[model samples]
Target chain A: MRRLLLAGPDFSLAAVDPHSTPGFDGGKKKGAAALADGGEVLSSLQEKLFAESRAGSEIAVLLVLQGMDTSGKGGIVRHVVGLVDPQGVQHHAFKAPSEEERRHSFLWRIRHQLPRPGMIGVFDRSHYEDVLIHRVRGLSPAEEIEKRYGAIRRFEAEVAASGTRVLKVMLHIGRDEQKARLAERLERKDKYWKYNPGDVDERGYWDQYQEAYQRAVERTSTPEAPWFVVPAERKWYARLAVQRLLTATLEDMQLSWPRATFDVEAEKQRLAAT
Target chain B: MRRLLLAGPDFSLAAVDPHSTPGFDGGKKKGAAALADGGEVLSSLQEKLFAESRAGSEIAVLLVLQGMDTSGKGGIVRHVVGLVDPQGVQHHAFKAPSEEERRHSFLWRIRHQLPRPGMIGVFDRSHYEDVLIHRVRGLSPAEEIEKRYGAIRRFEAEVAASGTRVLKVMLHIGRDEQKARLAERLERKDKYWKYNPGDVDERGYWDQYQEAYQRAVERTSTPEAPWFVVPAERKWYARLAVQRLLTATLEDMQLSWPRATFDVEAEKQRLAAT
Candidate 1:
């Protein structure tokens, strides 16, 4: 999965097929079964991570999701991270910066939302927006846009050094798939709230957005915080692959429950009398 | 369920049997199945509540869970609230106050954690702790403690008036059940971190704590924000009851999908062209 999805030196978004389910040969039925199976594993690992936090362990995990409209970023959050204890999960969705937010450095708002120890933090859209949208729409100067890549690299490196594992995923979906999704939203009254007219304007910049994503992934996919471009045209595959990525990242942490801080036997005796 | 669980004018903590499942007739097997089924209904209601928020709906739900240690408050958070999209749930587990927190009003920290518009807020332990622990442990003067009940009553009244429904629940567990839970924690290495030695000390004051709870519930149970004393000895019953309470509260809101602000047909035509 890593070999297929991880953005390498020669990685290009155009080369990866959004419809392909790499590494997993299973069809939809097997993918659904695997996802259900993965939920239990993810929940247990998350609990251990949370338990370790009680012992003052500084470890945490951050998942940064970047993608176009209808790329299933919200789906990954709902289907994947939803399997764990909500108490231990810190989920944030970054919209356009508020007036107060724009007053600070781009990383300032991002820094404020980093997970506390022993949490799995998820960003629906994150710091990459500073480079992606800014570059695609000329929201920032050429030199300024050029510098955020190094800034993000340094920021993520510091985050890793502080015991937070950063997992960055970009959900890759085809233009046709996006149009279908937007049309479905438009057609369904229940989905109308999610149907934004601005999304159609953004669709016109599909190639520019793709170029922006390719550049962003190329510049900032570091060893500490590598980017995984998941094929997201098939929603099930996208959800399953991200779940595997998250579960595997947690497994690699190798966390265990913190030992009792007090004398267990004595506490047992005391508890009995109570 | 409402009639069976709601705290009324004649409510008494001692009269309510913690072992009895008042509204639910089924045993553990049926209870588990019911909980699983309820997750689907709860998830749908929660999503509607969230979607409504996007279109400027001020509606929200605040679940305040207050109980003795080992009363399965965390279990409800994991099994019940965990069923919903974490994106729409604001969960805050209040520990003992920090030096800074102590400097402000008890409600200060609580106001900060209240759910934003169109969110479900869960407080693992809530402002009720001020009355329960403070009265039991004499953490505050009798006069000041007396004043806080009215303060909380008025505060919740304003909270409800502003479009947030507050559901206060006290997880009622017998002393023996708490002792068994604490002993189990000490018995397992994986559970050791949850075994706080101070919990045994707290158990010594169980009767006083119950009296504190009785008085708090009596004083604060109002029409706007009623308290529900959930018999929590059966973990499954407690979880199912809370899920029902949350689902019912959300259903009462009668939220519908926000109408599209844009011209759907025009947007569809534009989207197709793009």
Candidate 2:
């Protein structure tokens, strides 16, 4: 499933069916139950990863999630990452750049959010947002947007070389699906707080967003930090798939509970006397 | 207990008995039990603080722990902070300043670690370390050290006005307690890694360190962000007291779980239909 979902050079947004469940065979109830199971297992692995970090193993994992509004970035954070020990997880939900952040290169704020050793860092929206939003909204010049892609690639490469595994996922949702979700937000008084009227303004440029995301993915998906385009129309499948992606990546690291540095028997005896 | 531990104009280092439990009524087992209870309550409050931040409230808490080696800052982090949801807790252990950090004023690195709204930020050693160590070692001129006291007060005042509650703790341990703990570190082969040879050199300046800490506390313990002097010879007592200190400050915030701004029933319907 990881191999299939990994975005390659020719990774096309057109090929993915937003509603498809891919390798998962579960319905909603089954998918949710599976997510709970994955979360518990992931929780323990995350603890070992954290323990190993304190034990001085330099390895860590980072998950980057990006998508349009109502695509469930918040849900993913609340569910998948939420399952891990919060101590082991560092979450950054990138909002608009601050004046200080804007004064620097786009990567300045990106660097601040990188996970420390023994952490599972999640970027609710990441450096990719800079490129996607800038290009779709004509915020940055095309030359600058193009330049950012390489900069981001170089940055991720540098981080990967420093012992952080990066997993980038683009929650893929269809136009109709997004419309339904937005309409739901508008219709529901409680979700009104979650709704942004500006979201509708961006929906008008849906094609550009898809194009921007495709180009960004095509340019930045490298072996060290490849992008995953998860079909997200099925909220259950999207959540489950991300949970599975995280599990697979950590499992591949083969992190173990770190060995105690002190002598257990002698210390036990001495402490007993004390 | 909060009233007693909080330092004021006459906060005397000579007066605070390092072995005294002060306000606490319990022994080790009792202190341990209270800490567990406080931790459980604090965890819930921290979650609400975090949720309120996510819900758009601008309040946070910062707990700064400072003391000599073997003073149990690490234990407090492991035991007290370990009780809270790791996600809601942001812990920063400050070391020597880097080239960039040294370029700025002492408070520069401190600004970087202030808890975001809804975060319980614990600084294992903080900006106060600059004044404490620099003064005791004569690393900085006396005038510079004097200037820093005012600087810290101002910086903390600014954060307080911005809605961050600051609680500074000095874990006061006796000379005998320090000697015993350090000796224990050397005697246990496993604890060898924790033993630092430099600690012995610092022990030589014990009188100067006490004087420096006293001056710093007396000058900077404002009502908005007061310093607490916790007796540390009794490790369990110190831990429980600090935990209590934190819980009291948070409870004072009176932060409520924000009512849902959006219509719950309508969003539920929309989500259900989707």
Candidate 3:
């Protein structure tokens, strides 16, 4: 699933069908079952990673999620990242920059939120926003936006070098799916809190956002930190694919429990006396 | 369950059986089933609380877990706190104070990690540690330890007044149970990472620790912020009780989705055009 979804050198967002489920021959029922099974694996693997950290291992995992507003980023967090122990998971959702945040470089806040040793850090909407939104809305000048692409590449490269496995994912959803999601939010009183006038306004630049995402992926995709553009028209498939991606990455780390720091036999004898 | 577990006047730790499942009649099977059912309720209440926060509601909930070694404090974090959306949860596990942390009063670190509006904050061990372990180990002078109890009362009072509900729970496990759990950790290779020689040493002071907990509860339990001494020998019952306590507290908050900040019809029309 990781290889199939990777935004490789030949990858193009325009050619990838948002409705297609690549490399998986399963319907919703099968996908849901597989996801449930994956949860056990994910949980076990995360524990080992956390245990390893206690022994001074610097290794960690960072899952960076970039997607349009309604493309199931929150759902992935609830379902996939939620499968692990909350203690080992550091979940952060980035909104528009605050006044203090604006005073620093874009990566300043991102750096501060990076997962520490033995944690799985998740970014609901990450540094990719500076490039995606800033490009689409002209929040920064074109040259400044161009420079962010290289900056992001170097920043991610540094993160990858520091013992953190970086998995960058873009939940690719079609224009119509986003409209349907927005419509549902507006139509349901229970969901009204999620509906925003800004979301409706952003829809007018659908093409521009897509183009910006494509460019960001093309410029920043690297061997150490590749982006996976998962088709998210089917929510179940998107969730399953991301879950598999995360599980596979952790499994590749080959984590093991740290050796006992104390003498087991001696400790057992001491405990018996107590 | 909340009323039964409350540390009211005349409440004594010795009177409570660590193995008994008070206010709950069922054993593990029934307890597990009810816990699964409660997960749905917890998730729903958490979402409403999260939604209300978006509309500028200052309301929040804090769950503080204090327990002996191997009393399943981490289990409550996994089973009960894990039942909700991770995005809405803020979990912090307090360890021994660091150089910087020691420079401030005991409550300084606690105040720094307080849950913000529309979130559920959890502390594995909190300010009460000053009175519990400090009293047990003589980490501070006797008068200094006595002062923390009053400081804690005022600190929690301020937190409660700031629209955050405080649910303080001590997972009470018997000495025999702790010994059994520690022995098991020694018996399993995978559990070795959790075994500490110090845990067995702490066992020698079990009676003193109990007296300290009793005094701490008597001094600090109040109308606005109360402590609940949960019998954690039965792990299933402890998880279920904590889950229910959280759900009941959130339900009492009467959270609703924030009313739409924008004109729904107008937003729908604007959405349809794009």
Candidate 4:
């Protein structure tokens, strides 16, 4: 069964297969080309969206990116969203629980970081970690973990109802690819320190975590907050797919600048006096 | 009198050419080569600093960027700090006061955005705005503003004393260059909306603002938080200067990754069992 939909009338999986197995290497090359193309498209789209949002002052965009280590989350952000006006974009990366964050529910830290109207907020990792890390580490009981998934869906639904359009992406990288990246980091002395022994411990649960992610993606993906299982083996393809998703989402909203009553000519003349 | 200092042992204004001007034609031909060189150096330095901060586990960096309109705060941010690990970098842009913000003291919102330990926080326009905007708009009495300046200096000194290195930059663009940018924005249909008629109104007070900025730089800049009046007429030069400043500052700190006590081989073997 097809889990995600690509752009246009065609629901063909060709757009999604570029990061899958046999075509992985070729997929990487093609993904790079797609990123270049998608990057240009997204840049133009983002500018238009920014202008309309600033002008109309109605809609806001919240881009939620969740992925495992080396899953190309940062790469997607750098290439696809880098062109937007910094003043209009806010990026928050949620890390290990702070004292204040641990004192509250998992969602508290993220709530304050939501974008205001007419702005874009990108979350590098989000509340989904409550399920991902807690489940993997046994931080919560099994029943409680299941319950939180329902809570998350409802929480996200409420957010959608409140004028924010959410784009959630889960970057999926294969075990072999993850191993290769880990090895590459070890090979370079400069990056050796970035490699944590704990990550290797996590890798032991590769299959279990993959199954966990698959279940999460299937269960949590909804019309209002669909999850894009972006294959991260090919970084370029992952970025392009995310960018295309973002552009399509923004276009669907059909945002435009708000109308103002200021007189342009008179204001220009007034400014010239200064 | 020299108001800004380059970060080096042989710091001298004589090393900088006052008459040098770089054009912004949007073509990659003009200052692209120089910008690229500066970008490469900045990226390498940023990478090293990030690695070190992650290892130290307690150090933080607060990068404060302030400038007039079109002084390339966005450009410098895009180029200089663009390559750092997004997970470790937090960017905050301060805008004109929202109703809620106006209800509190000016520094209320800013204090909340300071960098957490082992992270880098970039402030586009910061507490300095209180002095700049309040003075420009006459929102506060002269004595109150003066007192705030001293308070700011002390606040920053305390932050520096507390392991957060503060680096402030004032992007200095020429009056004529600013007019050219304003003209280009007005001419382009896509950018016309960005041209608020009030920008021209503010242009009349360009000299007054310049004097105000000069005074602010002279009075507040100290050993704990030195200011760099980067020449902004040339966007590449300004970015390069900022990159150099950041690189030098990070180098002075001699940062290294924190030592971790995990056995990678054992962890790998443990993971292999799963």
Candidate 5:
């Protein structure tokens, strides 16, 4: 069975430098059409997976999407997983912690949003923010921050044991790409509002964040909940990779239509009378 | 603005029961081709509306779906509102109250799920159930139930005053139609799993529930939140009515795109360097 994992950096032309290697050219070279086809396949497979989840009443899937500022997280969710049955899907977009969320353990909000049976839950940004944001801002003591890595792994393992399959993805984009993307947003009158001045300060810590992500990935990518390094220079490629991973995961589950027990003739008669 | 409500008996088969007025024959009859066309139009309109909501960052829309067992609430949500951007849309399916929910006010759970600016929130079964279920089950006194009608009106008024537009729909089907649907479920092997003997007991209270629902609708259908009586015998027609109602509500909001503020020349330079 193929394990489900998909992660990438957001290097969209709207947010990244057009000349960046992982930009449009990377996407085109990676076979954009093939990626789109993969997306279509994923959409078809998701329907069956959803029905099976409802019928078999088995495992749940958790898709973790993480990226830097202006990463195409919103766009990917909009275009890719948008086709799935909303009733069978739950989306949790993590934002800056509220007063209540901050008062609890870091995992409290995530624990509350965990998908129920027969549901696929998508986390826009997840627990890793504890490391990512805290590390960057020096919010937590170094020792405590390091300790969280093990905590996350154990928490995820417990979730896996309880019938939830976790897949985490890290979007990798270069500084040049980020600058270009930010520039585009600044240039476009319509998109200017999305360009936050503070992002430049964050850009200064880009390399540091990348190293941190790489270390986090190496440490936390376990058998129970693996992390995929998605090459996201190309939006199309990233989208396709995520879709393929999701499709393979569902296919591995070997979902089948549950057997129906209704008598067709009786139903036909009922329909006729109705 | 025209209010879109979905009020129909659970299942009223027109072919079997010629006396069924809840069937789609009264409105524009939607055949397969028309259904497909309407779906396309609805999909496009919903997409546009979602974009407008995200860009304008002002108005929010709430879709309230009420129906009996197997009334196609899930199907309608999957097919109709499925086209909107997930970032700008949220789906909340209310279930039996949890221990915590039972401890709080009836409106507590619902109050928390209200859509933020620039989003559409869908309620599979909403607050009206307090009146519908509690009345039918005799969980509350007649005086308390009457008081709830006022509470509902006030709650809706508060929401609407806060710039949230509510579209309440009551899916109406006839008893014979419901029987046909239930029989179809029982006859099909795959669908048999969905049938419960308890549903029949609930079906027995159909007239009483209808009276309760009628009273609730009559009392709570204020200018802020009007209810529409939708003929749900035809799934296609029901979907169209919902789409039309949604589009009209969005149009009433007068949405527009947010202004951008990027520097084009500098962005081009940044892109060229990337």
Candidate 6:
């Protein structure tokens, strides 16, 4: 699974098939059960984190999700992170650069949305979008994109040092899968709002987007926060993979419930009297 | 029930008993069942607000919670808001003013945290504390505090005009109820993080705090955003009342799923081929 999902020093996106469910071999039925288990553990871990936060624990988890259009970013949010308490999760969906945002360095807005202590923050489409979309579309100069890669590495390292476990995932789906998903959206009257012509226009630059994504994964997959390329053609697999990644990342943090600070027995006596 | 929860023009803190559950005839079990029902409705309403947000509907909901320490503000967040998608809820817990915040007007930070279009914003301990605590503790001078009443009225009115419905709640509890809650916290080893010695010190000025809260409520309970005085001695009742109040506020918005915008028939053909 690590060999399949983790972007390595010599990683090549061309070597992996987007349709392949690399680590998960079970059928969709089994995948559903695994996801449920993952969801339960994830919820408990998140609760422990925020509970410890009450005692001033600065530990936090940040899930940075970056993917192509219709790669199930919203699905991951609703299916996985939705299981936890809203107070424990801070969800920030970064849209196009506002007029004021365009004036500042890219990381300025990203910095403001970084999860505070003990939060499980999901960045719907994060800093990586800048390098991916901007590079593919030439929103920024080539030199600036390169500089951003280096900046992202250093920024992520600093975040890790400050006690945030950064789990980055790229929902890798093939061109045909994207087409089917887009078409499905178009077909359903209720989903028409989600279907944008801009998405079709972007599909014309498919090769460029693929190249941009490959470069981003290779460049930013640091030891601190490596990118996971989950085969998202099967959304069940994608959601499950992301959930498992989060579960492992949080377990590694070794967060514990806060210890008591008051006189427990005497207080218990007082409460019992009441 | 309306008489119990709604603060009227002739409102007096002295007239209401903290231990009384005036409107609710239900025991804790019934209260729990009602809370579950309210939770289900609140979740659905919030989803509609966000789903329709794509079409540029700016309507949102903000629940401002105010109370003395250990007043179950945290419980409401955990129980009621916790049922909804984290993506749809934005919670801000206001603390003491930072040096930078102290430099600005008191409403500055409050304005920044107001829920964006299509989201439910929760203030755990909100700007009301400025009036409640500041007035009781003499954190600011008398004239400054008096000026704040007018400022808050103006600020909240402007927010209301901008498509947000404000539901302000004061968790009303007596001194003895607070003592028992504090004692319970002290008893539970796991709850020590929630216990603060300052809570006990603040309780020394319980009468003054009540007076300040009464004045704040009487001064700022405008027609746009009336204050709900929840008798919070019974945690279950407090939770159920809050959930119902939020349900009604959201229902009043009359939000619905957005209409389709694309050519449905043509899109259906395109999807069927894929």
* Number of the predicted model whose DockQ against the real structure is largest: 1
lDDT of 4 at B173: 71
Better of 1 and 3 by DockQ: 1
Each model's Cα RMSD? 0.7, 6.3, 0.8, 4.8, 6.0, 3.4
Name the candidate, 2 or 4, with the larger TM-score value.
4
Q: Tell me which of candidates 3 and 4 scores higher on TM-score.
A: 3
Model 6 chain A: which ten-residue window has the lowest total lDDT? A265-274
After best superposition, candidate 4 residue B209: deviation in angstroms? 1.7
Candidate 4, residue B167: how far the Cα is off, in Å: 2.4
Query: Residues A1-274, candidate 3, lDDT per residue (tens digit)?
Result: 7788999998899998989999899899999999999999899999999999988899999999998889999999999999999999999999999999999999999999999999999999999999999999999999999999899999989998999999999999989999999999998988998877898888889999999999999999998898999999999999999999999889989999888888888888899999
lDDT of 3 by residue, B231-260 (tens): 999999999999988898898898887898
Two-chain DockQ for each candidate model: 0.90, 0.10, 0.84, 0.31, 0.31, 0.38
Q: In model 1, what is the error at residue B110, expressed in angstroms?
A: 0.6
TM-score of chain B of each: 0.99, 0.97, 0.99, 0.84, 0.84, 0.97
Q: Per-residue lDDT for B33-89 in model 6, tens only? A: 888777677887888888788878989999999998888898888878877777888
RMSD of 3: 0.8
lDDT of 1 by residue, A1-274 (tens): 8768999888899999999999999999999999998899899999999999999999999999999999999999889999999999999999999999999999999999999999999999999999988998999998999999999999999999999999999999999999999999999999998888988889888899999999999999888999999999988899999999998899989999897889888887787776
Of the pair 2 and 5, which is ahead by lDDT?
Answer: 2
TM-scores, each model vs. reference = 0.99, 0.69, 0.99, 0.83, 0.80, 0.88
Q: How many residue pairs clash in each candidate?
A: 0, 6, 0, 9, 50, 0
The total of clashing pairs for model 1 equals: 0
Interface RMSD of 4: 3.7
Residues A135-206 of candidate 4 have per-residue lDDT tens digits of 888888899889988988898898889888988887777677777777666556677667776677787777
Task: Give the interface-residue alpha carbon RMSD of model 3.
Answer: 0.8
Tens digit of lDDT per residue, candidate 2, span B1-274? 8888889887899999999989877789988888877877887777778778877888999999999889999888866876676667788889889999999988888899889888999998999888889988877998998898898989999999999999999999987788789778756544565655567768778898899899989999999889999999999998898888888888999977666565656645544454
lDDT of 5 by residue, A195-242 (tens): 655677687677678767766776778878888766566676667667
User: DockQ of candidate 1?
Assistant: 0.90
